[model samples]
Target: MKRLSFFVLSIVFGTLGLSFVSWSCNKKETNTIVSRELSSKKTYLYEDVPFDSTKVASFFVKYPKLLTFQKSIVALYKNRQYHYAWFDKKGVNEAAEMLYNKMSTVQEEGIQKNFPYKTDLDVIFQNSKTYLSPNLDAELLLSSLYFFYAKNVLTGVDEEATKKIGWYLPRKKLSYVSYLDSIIAKPELLAKDDKVVLGQYYKLKEILKKYRLSEQKGGWNPIRVAPDFKSIKPGDSSQTVSDIRTRLFATNDIASDNKSKVYDTDLVKGVVKYKKRNGFKEDEVITQKHIDEMNVPVGERIKTIIVNMERCRWISEEFLQDSEYIVVNIPSFKLTYVKNNRPEFKCNVVVGAMMTKTVIFSGKMSYIVFSPYWNLPTSIINKDVKPGMKKNKNYLVQHNMEWNNGNVRQKPGPNNSLGRVKFIFPNSNNIYLHDTPSKSLFNEESRAFSHGCIRVGKPKELAYAILKDDKNWPTDKIDAAMNKTVETTYSLKRKIPVIIGYFTAWVDDEGTINFYKDIYERDNRLSSILVEEE
Candidate 1:
């Protein structure tokens, strides 16, 4: 095969914009793609050996199954000007070896797709003497394998699939070409403890490994359901109590498994801790529902953990580094505020019901409106107001609502649907966080009663935290504004990013894994796609 010149290859693909020439296949050649501007001129040059188009074409022909990654593989090669990225004069480089090992054990990362060229990759690494020369086939195969691993692990199902399943959060876009460049330059980074996926993803993987080991060692048996059992409250004694004890112990909800059949004080404490972590009421009672949750097989729980890991992959680490931000986890029915990489506080929140699910997205919280008027949405007006008006002529008067320019809006006060204050994050979805008069709903184990927007339980505390740094809004002023009958809007000097996300499984900073109900039924939808691919 004739040696291909970098300048010639660039001209053939004029879109690459070639202006200089340099070529070498020697071991000492620099592995770099440089683009610089000369005196009133732009120049592009590759400081490495360029691959022959004929060899790349022949390799694809032999391995036709990997044609799906043809575009990506070509782009990757063009980015480096066909440099031997996966190998040096000695043998396969460290990055290639590390990626090969990761691909071989991709299941540990919750990926189930089998590599298409697994045997070919094994042969190259297993017997390096037979593949001594700079093998284009091995290099291309590694590049293609990396893309496959990244697509399934780093990026979940495509954006369209996620959006179809009601996940509207922005999908993370990563440049594998640039990522490979960095890895090739510093091989040690491949071995670093730093996370390549989202921070939560790494945490979930750690939990997954433990769970899989548990599953392999004969997981816990299902708790027996008694025909006469109504509920197991504190001080109740039965075989079920012993089963609960063992189950809770397996999950570390209880420190010990004494195997005692009596529901003692220690058992009660364990029940409370389990309920709190599982989004149930923190009471010393074990109902059938709680039993059902505990009885969910470890295998199914593993699948749930894997599904949430894919969700973590969608989030960008850049967002987590914000100086100040607000994150509302829909499944957990909780909101957390973070400042300077530390969680300031967390509060209970009420999200939308199944039919009217809150959108999963992110925006900037720029304003806080105190005693905000409730401009009823069209759906609410058509569904509730119009029908109620037909039954009662004075419905508007009774509800403290009035007609404002052909639209009915509730007056700003304690009676307003948006109870005392509202946090506005401008977006097309028209959803925001606000206070509600239905304080009792917050006490419910499953608080998904809102129309679409989030109903915060501690609106006053949230407002105080948001405006604590600003001298213009003191505690007295904030209280006064919230109590006023008229609507008052305050613009925040620095906008905080608000991310409304859905995560059914999460690991807290304390390394405790908490699981929540998939309120919107999104897990099965995502899991189905993964299963189909598998």
Candidate 2:
């Protein structure tokens, strides 16, 4: 009787232990959804902290107290993301979780004590990585709680982090922050900024409680992906001219020239201001040429957008350390080399025509020259010169072009075609940029007007930049170098990589994905292969 009773007790205890294990497992998950109070778990976004350039580094480092409120933030700081790092799905999930947890731990009170007065998102996006440096500020240790980790893996810290704080609770509900708007056409809460945020932007935040742009189930939105690059095919006369132009000069950067586009004198000039701003001919007429420009295929435009987008993506910038860098928007027919974050030097460039469109690539600024000489490309000689020589026999002499394949070479002269000066960034394409003799084309907008090269808007400034690095080779000497065949290379202390790119749609400085007319129209053909159309 004793043995049977003991066995019964053992069985009962074992069942109780199993029940306890299951209860604990279920409780943790339930706690995540129901137990946490929204008001008790307060959070902040980028606006809570305003920028103060003086206190950068100290604000970005990790603190022992931060670990007390947050465990995830500590794990994130420990992760190392060096180049050539491979990321699998597991890594991505963990990183995202860590981010969500860290953002939740940050409190408004903590930000007030730690950061400079009224810090915002810009300070974190532009300067947080530098704040992580050892040379960081002492004030940051006491006050600043902002820091960047894993390079560009973190960008919208202040604003983005604040939104993430909501994840610990239920996701489908709603947010007071307008940027966190869900299906509702309006945001729960918002700060009045005139730019487009995540969703539900209110125009006059004061007049109305909120205004929202409802999410559409499906319709004609993706049309902007490669937008109709060409007009609705040729000979389709039913379409209004304005409709065609509306899609053509839709870029926010450009405006239509003459609003009164009647089919006479005014129409003859065709979209003047838009054409002019884009470095195209200011003729406002919607002529056959204009139609052809509008008719460029969608496939080519997609290629342009993809290539240029790649260029922007490749730019892993930590901060705008240097105020400016030379930017050559290949498809746009313009060049602006900025300084101190402003366009100090801008020039009209003659880029490659469709047939010999310049390859999208990049290199660095080595130096600029005062007087630069031109070494004509061999391809030009073969394609342009040899054909002309066949007709004129004295073709080489007329253009001052000489050819003796055996131990002799063509020398430079007035008709050499390489113009007075050129910018050099040596690459595999055998394409060294130079000035051109056809200066009038600079006035045209659709400047797909070169034999696969780039022409600068301001040639003189480029000349100054090239030679400025060489102390002995003063600006005056640059002009002298041009007349003489003195081919010299001015190496840089650090050669910055130059990226020659082609993009049709890009987010501007204000973070808006501004679209352009895909001159080449190649996106659809490529995108079809890469993405499913449904």
Candidate 3:
């Protein structure tokens, strides 16, 4: 691979700028006096060697910054344990050590915890003459992380669903990690006299520079006071109105004895509204939720967006240009499907409740079963099943539940726990999309109500839209499979990709971020990781 010019590398990093990982912990004052290996470090010409051998070991000793850089890489792997990155047992421990070493180096430099160990993106770009760009580094890092993340996660995969994954043909190749090698090796960006290359790099630098970190607000915080008179609605308490409006109109310097200057009604309303929006009782008082949002100050919202912009950098860069896909915004409880290149449909889909927050991931629709039989997950079976089984083994028969070998499954019917239909894309995680009979729960504003499976709204419409492209197929075909007592499966002619993502702030068609509440708390969790990477 040729050396990637600074210009080209910058552009690539800008688009996917947020680097990887760490945890959201309070920043401890880095006063812990840990002993550093006093032997001075030295850097040599870059050489590819077996991972974790002398070459990598030497690199760490030579450039401590490389350690910081490696810490960021390790973070990517650690997060993968939670996401779907693949690795084996030995790989997992090795990667963990790499991250730990890097973190130690940063700690020696008085770097704070919670903040990611920072490396200058430009420094690595310049190092391409000797060392490869981070693009290559990222490829290696992702590879290691993928191996470990996948390995660790697979240990926890449901035994029943494990067999189903290989059945779905692996059509889509994972490309981004491999692609980095080709991208960083491109020389056009590296040509020293190429002003255009430099200009492109600068432009991308400006773009990445725009990404500010999201505000790391936690616990109860302070509040601010703002008064607006026009917000007074009908049925106002005259005394309340008089007192509040007086404050709005009151002189800032007034030490005068005004007996009845009430609270800033609008500010209080902002508080009440904030409280109402969050999972809290809306009492319009200057309570915690209101105080936090109010104290955030409008000036900081842009900073919040900037931080979110950095977040885009944290995702895989090789995105799908064409596919039918569904994205459920947990904060919004809304689902969107994009066909070709435009959003063709949207619906309000319910997600897992607070205790069982919906995990964000990406997947594809492999098969949709009509009048689907629900295989009760072991976790639920242990919690909800045995109780019902013990209380009434008849509960299983009454609900058409049956045991296949050791796996407990429900027979397809109106009363089955899974409601009527299910959309399955075999993943290592065993999570799926399905329709639920608990329709009334959807009406709730804070609808995080499922155990794990995504409960789609108007699943019949989804089924039809997915199948409409097929020739001569009608509802009767579906009816043919469902009417009979046997469990039936129908694979679609075209598979739809489904991405369960976590973006507290994301760009719309206009490229403006439509900020949503961080329902899964992923933003803060990942935000600290991003900070740690830096």
Cα lDDT of all candidates, in order?
0.76, 0.37, 0.43
Instruction: Report the number of the highest-lDDT candidate.
Output: 1
Error (Å) of candidate 2 at residue 211 is 16
Error of 1 at 325 (Å): 0.9
Candidate number with greatest TM-score? 1
lDDT: worst 10-residue window of model 3: 18-27
Model 2 agreement with the true structure over 217-323: per-residue lDDT tens digits: 11111212123444333223333454444444343323453322233333233345334333345554444455554454443433433333222222222111233
What tens-digit string does per-residue lDDT give for candidate 3 at 180-215?
222223322212212112222223223223332112
Write model 1 residue lDDT over 121-225, tens digit each, in one string: 999999988765567888899889888876887777887888888777667666766666656655555443233455666767889999999899878888986
Assess candidate 1 and give its TM-score to the true structure: 0.88
Q: Show pairs that collide, candidate 1.
A: none
Q: Order the numbered candidates by lDDT, best leading.
A: 1, 3, 2
1 or 2: which has the higher TM-score?
Answer: 1
User: How close to the true structure is residue 185 of candidate 2, measured as C-alpha lDDT?
Assistant: 19
TM-score of each: 0.88, 0.46, 0.51
TM-score-based ranking:
1, 3, 2
